[model samples]
Target: MQPNQHLRILTISSMLMLVLSIYMVFVYAPLEIVMGAVQRVFYYHVASGWIGALAFLITLICSILYLATRNLKWDHVALSSVEIGVVFTSMNIVSGSVWARPIWNTWWTWDPRLTTATIMWLLYAAYLMLRQSLENPQRRRTFAAVYGIVAFVSVPLTFAAIRIWRTIHPVIIGSSDPSAEGNFEMTPPMRNAFFFSLFTFTFLYVTLLWHRIRLEQLTVQVAAMQSRLLNKLST
Candidate 1:
């Protein structure tokens, strides 16, 4: 089978999975007793967070691969991972903000999770810009790989720092009860929706990453062909 055909199948499957997840979230999931309709946003919010976390992890791995092999394909994979990571990270923040508005009584806050996510977004943005500044492809890849690996060190630190800070300065409401912060007890239907959302988003992530890497490959091929054409014309 052709490579493009395989990609097409994956793409279709991802779309179908997303559609199914939406159905499960809206129709099948039970309403929360506490937050009502707004609580539904948590499914997508958490899914985005999960994908973002996975993306950064993949970025770290691909960065190591690029450094070891000096292969441009690894660089492509790293770039694709960062780009997709940024997309999901943004989604996570936005959805979280929406969920917080009704529950937290504010659109934004310096809560641990919110602050950590913001910092992560900025770190990846810097990585993307770093890639743009260099003229040489090899140097660009090398620097980006280094940055990808190094930037990830902050992820763990950010999480730990947030947890520590929250402990020192806890939320007044339900601060005593750990569950009060995001503590909606899930009914069986809610649990099904939550798990289904996670499953669907994971499939979507794989599907997007595959297509993005293929596009990068095609781009390299096109550039090589164009360069060859130019050389022949000049001769």
Candidate 2:
């Protein structure tokens, strides 16, 4: 199939899955006895957080490949992944803050998990800024790959902050510390909804990544064509 046709299919599928996930989150999932409707946010919030980490992992892998092969294609993939990662991480942070307002009684906190997440987002944001500062394509790609690899250290740290230290953040999937707040038991339907939301987000991520990669490819082609046009005009 043509590239446009494939993108169209992906767009349709992602939209359908998104709609289903929203319904599952709001209507199908059982309401929490304590948190009520606000708890529903947990489904997409956790999923977006997971996707953010996954995007960083993709960047890390692409960075490694670019460093080893010095391939521009890998650099493009790494850049696209980091761009997507930043957006998803921003979503995760915003949703967490929204959820925190009612549960933690404040919109912001210096809790371990929240603190590390903010730092991680800043690190990646800096990575983008670093790329913008460099003009030489080779140097830019090299520095970006190195920075991307180094920045990934924050992802694991952010994930483990809650587990390693005492925090008010809730642990949903695994063994929870006694001090963990906002923790709740999930019913069967809730579990199903949670997993479905996760799958939906993963699918969405793949679709977005594909589109972003294509955009990067088109950008390179346009740049090359422009360079050729300038050279011909100078002659």
Candidate 3:
């Protein structure tokens, strides 16, 4: 099969899984006794958070590969991953705020998980901005690789925040701390839906990453062509 055909298949699979996941969240899963309808947000919320972290993890690995091999392909992958990670992290944070308004009585809090997540988003966002400020392409990619590796400290830190510090954030999967708010047990159907949503988001991430890598490659080609044209015009 052609590359586009393969991408199409993956994209279609992601869309179908996304539709099914929505049905599961709204129609299949049981409603929480406490939060009522708002609890449904938990499905996508957790999935987005998972994708966000997963994307950053990819960037870290690619960054390492780029530094070791000095391959521009790895740098391309790292940049694409960071861009996707930022969007998903933004979704995670926004969805959390929407869910929290009713449960926590406020839209924002200084909870450890929340704080770390915000910081993680900002770090990656700054990474993108850092690329723009640097004029030397080689210097930019090298710096970005180093920064991407260092910034990944936040991924583990954010993940462990709820576990280590006193926080209102709930760990829905494992045992929850007594101090944690919005804790709930998942029924069989809810678990199915939750896992399915995670699978769907992973699929979506793969599809998006493929598209992004292609776009980045095309961009590099265009920029090179423009530079060539400029030199010819100057001569």
lDDT of 2 by residue, 185-211 (tens): 999999999999999999999999989
Give the per-residue lDDT digits (tens) of candidate 3, residues 1-235.
1269889888898899899999999999999898899999999999999999999999999999999999999999999999999999999999999999999999999899999999999999999999999999999999999999999999999999988888889998776678887888889999999999999999999999999999999899999999999999999
Q: Which ranges of candidate 2 are over 4 A from the true structure?
A: 1-3
Models ranked on lDDT: 3, 2, 1
Weakest lDDT window of 10 consecutive positions for candidate 3: 1-10
RMSD (Å) per prediction: 3.2, 1.3, 1.5
Query: How displaced is residue 140 in candidate 3, in Å?
Result: 0.4
Report the lDDT tens digits of candidate 1 across residue range 10-118.
8898899899899999999987887789888888887887788889989999999999999888889889988998999899889878877777778888866677778
For model 1, the superposed segments whose C-alpha errors exceed 4 Å read 1-3, 158-162, 167-180
> TM-score of every model?
0.90, 0.97, 0.97
Go through the candidates in order and give each one's C-alpha lDDT: 0.82, 0.93, 0.95
